[model samples]
Target: MRKFTIALDAMGGDFGPHISLSASSKSLQLHPNLFITIVGDAQQITPLLKKYQLLNHNRIKFVHAPETISMEDDPVSVLRHRSQSSMLVALQLVAKGEADACVSAGNTGALMLLAKHTLKTLEGISRPALVSALPNNRGGHSYLMDLGANLQCGCDTLFNFALMGSVLCEQVEQLSAPSVSLLNVGRESNKGNDTIKQCAEMLSATEFINYIGYIEANELFDGRADVVVTDGFSGNIALKSYEGMGRVFFERLQQAINTTWYSRLLGKVLNPIIKNQLKNLHPDLYNGASLIGLRGIVVKSHGSANESASFYAIEQAIKEIQWQIPACISARLESVLAERDCLSHE
Candidate 1:
């Protein structure tokens, strides 16, 4: 396999250097062809390096970025003032072609702002969408886009999302023609507002899209479609609600299992099975959210990610690198747009 160099924001997450640097060690071990440059304060990174015993590995290196953009930092303000911050520096590595991709567990708003300023969106893409995969009924994954990115998207913006989302599902998941759905309240054609209705029309007319019509929120994980496209507003609400439900469901399940001695004993017997199910739904397993439509690859790990979660993000970036995902999206996008433009004029 071809080697990939990753630029990691080493000090920005809730767990700081310990989790991020340790994740680097895990990634390097898993992929021998991978190289990582951890961007953060030398003072903070060195101890973690020593603790993890990762300094001697030539594939792992560091760049001193003394500043950090905290979770509470204003995205616009950080972009203007924190030029030397680890988040910005790490993104810069990807823009400068020094790194194949950048992975961060940092301020989401700040990362999005910095990425747009540094790399810009791809040609024909209106905006970058925050996308992640979720386990579906088919024992495979479904891609959801505009997770919290474009809050108030237009019909065209929603159309762009479907285009980007379908390409993403195809490139990353190796789906030849991924089935896509527009998330809405009802499955009827007339259910959604003007934007979604019109967007659906566009999707239907597009010969390239494997458009599967409307899907309700309840069917999100039913394997009804391989990809779900929505504006950031509703998509964000649904995503958070889904995540909250998963946590609450497992907590309640555990409580019920421990209600009595016999039940507790049964719980222990079923512990491994429960753990496996939890692993499938765990936020850590799906920690990385790809910022698609950008000129370079950027994977956003959840801010609260631990070592394993952070490693998942790194591995995601490595896969994108191996697949040349961005290039594939760009090529597919150019074809789709060009074909549309031709029909528009004709």
Candidate 2:
């Protein structure tokens, strides 16, 4: 009765209904009062829902939307023709106030375009950046922003990115005076290019942010800062590299254990411990990234997401709605910008 419902796109990701159904089963089981309106072709989703025995639940409803948005299709064109497409329908539900949030594992570009076009950005927000929560060696996690949204950015954009990332920490991470840092090659005050130098100055001069100096790549895993801000291009490459390194290490560890009898025995003993230690590094756990600064909370999961990943995304959407993160962020930004404007006048 809390009026918390999420609009999910059943046809978004690579695995489509399979992942969606599995995630839905888990989500519905965990939250009895929660409702989800899955948007997709009835012909495709009905069978899966029935097979999973989720068809009869009053809380679980299906909205008949038959079109699909392809990864290769033009984002604008797909949103136009595929008016009934699962992604568009899900977003529309959020825009129309029927759902609290929208979750999609579909084309990232298309989702951003539709979210911007449909719900529009918060007042004064230049662009919405894809932000993720990543594990830190110290403990818990940190927020990394502009992971895959903008490529070419100005110093002002980076400054705004820092503010947005901090707002997320305050709202989602519940951190007071969250430490903010810039991604750069060195910690020196005069390091790298003009962009880095200018951003360093801006961050140092910021009143709201707990401005830490430049953090190197190695410091990212060491928990050097709470919110790390960078352009989308650099942030994307860093995220991909982190994932790639984790996979390579996991596979190598498995292969080393299979080579001989003694090694196999040792591996069996250590595998469980190793897995427990590395659980945070799994893609399934961190697959969902929130497109911050939007009017509604939009969670973008990996395109190749499986059931586990899908479920995490849906769960995140639920929490975002509960926390009213989008609304809180908008208010925070407006306040911060207003304060800055008043100071400039003084």
Candidate 3:
């Protein structure tokens, strides 16, 4: 079995090393061939590793990073000054081939800037887009891209997102020619802004892409499209809305179930079934969003992630490393760009 090494930014996110160390310990036990490089303040991480009884584990290596990039830190400022921060150090590990991948629950903007600078984008990929799977009604997940990465994208950039997203869904979801759609105001051709309309036209003309026209926000989880592409601003808003709605829905349902004696009795019978059915939609299960199009693997975990969510982020990194996602996307882009050039000449 091939051993995989993942570098964790132990001092990123809300709970910092507490959550990361617990997740790392759990991951080490789960995957015997997995090695972890914990990057953060040695003074802080050492005691926790001892708490987790992983202080001197053979499979674990510790790298002391003196600084940390806070969630509120400016991306540009951190990029210029915090070279020795835990987040940057973890990313450097992957860039230098010291680790297979890097996982961080750090500031999204900082991670994006640092990753793009250190690892660089793959050939022909101008910028890296954040992509993650959202559970859909079809008993599977739909891939969404540009989630809070590039806030405003041009037509060509949006087109690139579609290509990247399609490749991700095809490779990771094991779908043949996964259906791709642009998130629009409506399904009609003339329903969106100039950039979206132009992107739609480009996708429609590309024979290599399985372009299926437009999909509105309400249909995001309808599972009609396997890959949904959008600008970062819109995508981020839609993602947050979906998460908020899910939380509200579950909370209201529980409250209603406890409203009456009969309801309480019925809730006992339905609680297990509802939980099993909705387990896939749990936010923690989909906590890690991949910063795709980069030369190396980097996964961004939600800042508020707990032990289970953090573990899921680490697992996501392992899967991407095994899938060789960057190489796959590069090869796909080469083919797609060649086809575009051919179409242009004619």
Candidate 4:
């Protein structure tokens, strides 16, 4: 069995090292080839390891980091300074090739900055995209990109995001020439802004991309396309809104289910069906977002992730490490860009 080491920022999340260690413990159970280097204050982690009965585990190691980057830290500041921070240190390990991947339930801005500063972007990739795969209507997952990494986007960057998102869906989702769509206000060719229109045109004309045209917000989660392309600002708002709405929707439904004696009785009967639907909507289950276009696999777990959520992030890291996701994206990026360049010159 091939071994894959993940550098985990054990000090970054809301619950700190304890939650990270618990998640690491759960991950170790499933991935026998996995080894993890926990980066945090050694004292804080030692007790957790003992609690988890992981004190002498051969697969686990500890790297003492003295500092941390807070959720409010500016991305530029973290990038410029904070080299010894738990977030940066974890990224540094991946940069130095000591780890196959890095997983951190840290501040999104800080994590993205630290990753880009340490790992840089892949060739032909202008910036790394914050991507996550969400369950879709057709029992498949749709890959959405630049979730919160970029605030603004240009045509070329949008194109790159599309390529990166495409590579991810193809490699991870096992889709052959997966369909791509521009997240727009409407489906008409000229509906969105100039950048989106350009991206749509390029994608539609590209022979390899199964460009399916624009996807409105409602249809996106319905699996209208395999890849939904959007900039960071829009994507971030959309994602958070979706997650928030999911929470409210579920809570309201549960409240209604238990509103009356008859409703409560009916809820018991329909509990399994409702639970199966709710399972897919849980943000914790899809807690980790991939920092795509990086040189090494880096998964950014939500800073507020709980135990099982952090484990989900670790599992994401394993899949990316196992598939050599970054390398695969590089190869496909080179091919796709070369084709586009050739076409442009034609």
Candidate 5:
């Protein structure tokens, strides 16, 4: 059996040590052989480890990282200046082959910037996109890419996201020739902005993808597409809006019930079922957006991720490693890039 040690950023999220401590403790239980190196100030993490009763594990080690990078810090400047920041140290460990991969609930931009600079991108990959899996109301989950990494993307880049995301779907979701869709204003061939329209045309022509034409925003939760590719700006807005609306929808439902005794009785009757449904749609289940196009697995958890979310993210990372997803995607991408180069020569 191949052994792997994960480097966790102990001071990454908004909830601070509580989230990190909980994630690490639960992760150890999930993978008995899994080793973790928690990087952060001992003053903050040591007590939490004790509270979680994880202070005695020989497989767990704490590495003191003096500097901490806040969410507001500039990505490039902090990477260069704050050499000892916990997030940077965790990434460096992976870059130097000290750890198999890194999991961080930190600034998304900083994680991308640091990973690109340190570990470098895979062959023929220009810009790495953040790809995430969201729970579909229909069944299972759907994967979306360029979630927020690049604000704008070209047709070729959009195609790459589809190819990369397809590989992820196969490796992680255990799906084959998964249906790929372009996020656009309508399902028609000639809808959406110029960028989306052009990308749709390009995708339609691609031999690599199982392109299902354009998918409208309303169809996102309907599971019309297994892999949706779009520019980061649009994708990010759509994702955040879905999350916000999901919360608001449930909140209003609760408020409506609490306002009346009759409605409250109905709520009690359906409360357990509704709670289970909401749990299925929670953001934590969809934690860890993969930085596709990178040479290794780099998962970005929500900056506000809690312990359970972090644990799931780590489990996903472990699956990626076991499946050798990065290596598989690299081979497919090389083939695509080669074909493009041949066409350009003609």
Candidate 6:
């Protein structure tokens, strides 16, 4: 296997180096060819590295960043002031070609700002988007994009998102002509505002896109479409609502299971079956969201991720490196633009 290096923002998340370092250790164990550069305050990271017995590991490198970006820190303020922050350093490593990818569990706004500033977007991409997979009724996954990157997007931006998302699903999911759908208020042609209608028209006209009709929010996880496109506002709300509902469902089930001695006995007997069936709905399984359309790979983890989830984020970065996702998206966009040019001239 070809070796790849990842720069991790160790001090970005709620648990800081404690969680990041632990996840890095687990990742290194799983991927022997993987090397990690832990970026953060050396004073804090050094002790934890020693605790994890990875202080002198050959596969590990430490880059000290004097400052850190807090979850509450404004993106613009951090871009102006926190030059030596861990998050910035990690992204810079990718920009400078010192790392194959960068992974962070930091301020969403700050990370997006720094990633865009450091790495820039692809030639045709106006803004980077956050895309992740959601479990579907077909026992597979569907890709969703703009999960809180840009709250308001124009028709052009939405069109670009569909293209980007289509390429992602085609490459990562290895599906030919993956079906693409817009998340909207209704499926009928007459429904939705002007922006949605216009974006729908664009998608439908593009021969390169396998554009299906609109998908309502209720059908998000129905597995009818391979990729679902939406503005960040609606996508973010849908994602959070799904995650929240999963948590509530499991919590309520556990409560009922523990209500009485007979219930506890029944729960014990059904534990394995329940776990097997519900594994797909666990939030930890979908912890990493790729900030696509950037020049380099950037995977964002949930700020509240535990070691398991953080490791999943690292795995996500590794997969992107192997897949060469940026290159794929760029190539696909170029072809689509060429097709558009031909159509315009005719």
lDDT (Cα atoms) of all candidates against the true structure: 0.88, 0.85, 0.92, 0.87, 0.85, 0.92
Give stretches of model 1 more than 4 Å off: none
Task: After the best TM-score superposition of candidate 5, give how far the Cα of residue 1 lies from its true spot, in angstroms.
Answer: 5.1
The TM-score of candidate 4 is 0.96
Which numbered prediction scores highest in TM-score against the true structure? 6
Clash counts for all predictions: 0, 0, 0, 0, 0, 0
Would you give me the overall lDDT of model 1? Answer: 0.88
Of 2 and 6, the candidate ranking higher by TM-score: 6
Instruction: List pairs with backbone clashes in candidate 1.
Output: none
**What lDDT tens digits, residue by residue, belong to model 2 across residues 1-346?**
5768889988888876778888988998999778999889999998998888889988888899888887788887986787888899899999999988899988888999999988898877878889888889877678887888787677878888888888877777788988999898888877878987898788787687788888888878787799999888999998888878877988898899999999999989998998899888776787788887789989998888889989999887887887888787777777878877987999
Candidate 2 C-alpha error for residue 215, in Å: 1.5
Per-residue lDDT of candidate 3, residues 10-115 (tens digit): 9999986899999998999999999999999988989999999998899999999999999899999999999899999999999899999999999999999999
In the range 1-346, model 5's lDDT, one tens digit per residue, is 6778888888888889678778888888868778888899989888988998878888888889988888999998987798889988998888888888888888888888988987898887788899888888787889988889898898878878888999999888888788999988778776787777777777777677788898888888888799999999989998888778877887898899898899899999989988887888877688888887887778888887777788888887788888888899998887777777887899
Tens digit per residue, CA lDDT, model 4, 125-181: 878889898878888898888898898999888888888888888888788989888
Clashing residue pairs found in predicted model 2? none
Candidate 6 per-residue C-alpha lDDT over 1-346 given as tens digits, one digit per residue, 9 for 90 to 100:
7999999999878876799989999999999999999999989988999999989999999999999899899999999999999999999999999999999999999999999999999988999999998999999889998899899999999999999888888888789999999998889999998999999999999887899989998898899999999999999999999889988999999999999999999999998999999988888888899999999999999999999889889988888898899999999889988988898999
List where candidate 6 sits over 4 angstroms from the true fold: none
Model 1 Cα displacement at 71 (Å)?
Answer: 1.8
lDDT of 1 by residue, 224-298 (tens): 789899988888888778777877888899899989999999999999998886668766677798998899999
Ranking by lDDT: 6, 3, 1, 4, 2, 5
Please identify which of the two predictions, 3 or 5, would achieve the higher TM-score against the true structure.
3
- Models 1 onward score TM values of 0.96, 0.95, 0.97, 0.96, 0.93, 0.98
The C-alpha stretches of model 2 lying farther than 4 A from their native spots are: 1-3
